[model samples]
Target: MHKRSFILTCLSVVVIAAMLSGCAGTMVTPTQQNFKAPVVTLDSMEVAHAFGYWYFSKKVKPTKGKPDNVGAPLDLAFIFNIENPNEYAVKMENLKFTVAFEEFDLNTVASTDTMWIPAGKTNQVRVHAHFDVRQSLLSLLVTGGFQLKAKGTNAWAQLEKWWTGIPEYAVPVHVKAGAAVFKADGLTQVTTFKATFP
Candidate 1:
């Protein structure tokens, strides 16, 4: 009887070890080929703060040998939602997009802020864009001049309309040529997007 009991104990140990080995095999790590690109959407856009919306300074006094400058500042904040559909978490490495007022591309905004989105979950990111009247005027003249002329309007008039209309949601704002980089399990993906804001 003692010999029989010894044999049963050995068999039980072997069975337990086999079960553990099988469980370990089931716990496989996700590989690069298993990665999927995260979905990105424009959650909202806000005129966070705007001062001197209609105010323009010209021929300002020089300070510390700096040349005279003109400035009227506007700040906008864009919020986005990143959704990870994979079974593993994803890290957003960077995001960038062009800001367009109506049909004119005014500036390119970017964020290097990194965040990890959990598996089958979502995360939010906010990026800010700043615009100056003087720089915007130059951009319009150099890049969008022909587009403006075709529309039968001048640069200053268009700038004024944007400055006054954006805060009131009367003019449409666009996010164009957007690219966001995400990484997970040694895999990298670039996602592109375009959105319009009211």
Candidate 2:
């Protein structure tokens, strides 16, 4: 009986340890992650609005420094759609993202926020990426493609990935983004395309 109890106790300990590690982000970044696992994928991202004398209807020039107000500086708010295809609820906290304009070497960090992605549904996260507006029409002439990179982690998100049998983690997923197509007057050229998901 003592031997049987000892065996049972050892098994219990091992099972508990396994459960704890599974709930924790041991293999999830701060370690390793499966990027291509597709726990969550970027469904779509759009430049919903253009603020400043450029994209706005008003001809008033945006201010330079206190640019949150239109005519102060040129700013753009992008709408992002993130989808959780898994049945497990995955959450991301204090996620960081960057929209990089490699052609112009301009890059901006997105706003800080937490994203709670529900299972099998799409979550919308809006990021306002800002750039200092020059007095010239330079930004209006920006053309070509850019890259959007985002990284976020929650133990739940990681657990969900592993639950789906993905052993690796994919941090900072990269998506091919077209640059803000614009005309000479700062008017954004309206074009529709799709954002690819991994």
Candidate 3:
């Protein structure tokens, strides 16, 4: 009888220790996090051409100076930031995007579905934009910017810049977005990226 009780007691302790160890390695619930903005590189600007759209063809090589063509699509690519704080998965939805340079702004970009951001990481969202040359160029020109002329560009491109007012080369740019995130408690967290660029 004495031996049986001792064995039973030992077994109980072992079981308890085993259970505790197992629980220590268990996963925790995830929570919601805020989105972070990434630094954008705007130093090198080029006007590349696509046959039909921004990805259609390499019809024109990347040229510097000023962009003045009323033809082809314009390609602009940049990397931005998104941050998730919780261990739980956050579902990103309802993204509103704006791409602006100085006083020029475009509010036409939209996303239909949600983007998944895993827990505890700042995800870099690299955006490659395809803009209509006619609209984009005309926008800058009409907003008081002069045609920028790069040395290697052809004369037609040089003469073609539609901006007629006194040229302002220095412009500030902004890429902002309003994002909504689904959190752990079935709650919605909304955040905005609000910064202007050099």
Candidate 4:
């Protein structure tokens, strides 16, 4: 009787252990789907000359004790003509902008921003950037490229849940230019542009 009771207890333990293992193996977890951004090619670039201007306000100062005089503000603009050059339309969830002194990369740069783009379109992007006389005054400046990325979604969310599960895209900027100057601070930049289908 003792032997039979011991065997029964051992079998029960084995059964319970197997059941627990099975349940653990069947547990599910959420995961992000793999996504790829469309390939973009640069067709051409256009940049205007930077004009020098100054402004003084109640909060700021001017040169030679000038009484709070205001002058035209320094403005810089660039237009990029990009080509999709792809057969299929690419969905850009987020865009990344970066400024480089000589070479274009995430590191060894100044600032970065994110935006979005549509598919099969040649967009004309405008970047309003300001530069100041800091660091080395004689640093040679070149063009930079924006990095682009694509988001993945298995299903579309409804109006209330639309904000959920929407992935962002990243893109690179490639411009053809060299050597420029900007202000040290108080600079406002703008990039309002689009790409059209080629």
Top candidate, metric lDDT: 1
The stretch of ten residues in a row with the least summed lDDT in candidate 4 is: 159-168
Report every candidate's CA lDDT: 0.87, 0.39, 0.49, 0.33
Cα lDDT tens digits, model 3, 5-122, are: 9999999999999999888668554433433322222232222323432222234444654443445544555455666766645666645557664344644454545666776766
Q: For every candidate structure, what is the RMSD over all alpha carbons to the true structure, in angstroms?
A: 5.8, 18.9, 10.4, 20.1
How close to the true structure is residue 11 of candidate 2, measured as C-alpha lDDT? 100
lDDT of 1 by residue, 11-55 (tens): 999999999999878654567677778888999999988765543
TM-score of predicted structure 4: 0.29
Candidate 2 per-residue lDDT, tens place, 15-119, comes to 999999887744333111222121333453433343323222244545543323222243435555555544444554433344433222344443446555555
**Candidate 4 C-alpha lDDT tens digits along 21-42:** 9987864321122122233333
Displacement of the residue 103 alpha carbon in candidate 2, Å: 0.9
State model 4's lDDT.
0.33
Best-to-worst ranking by lDDT: 1, 3, 2, 4
Candidate 1 residue runs with Cα over 4 Å from true position: 1-28, 55-67
TM-score for each candidate, following the candidate numbering = 0.81, 0.36, 0.47, 0.29
| Each model's total of backbone clashes | 0, 15, 6, 32
Model 1 residue 122 distance off true place after TM-score fit, in angstroms: 0.6
CA lDDT of 78 in candidate 2?
A: 50
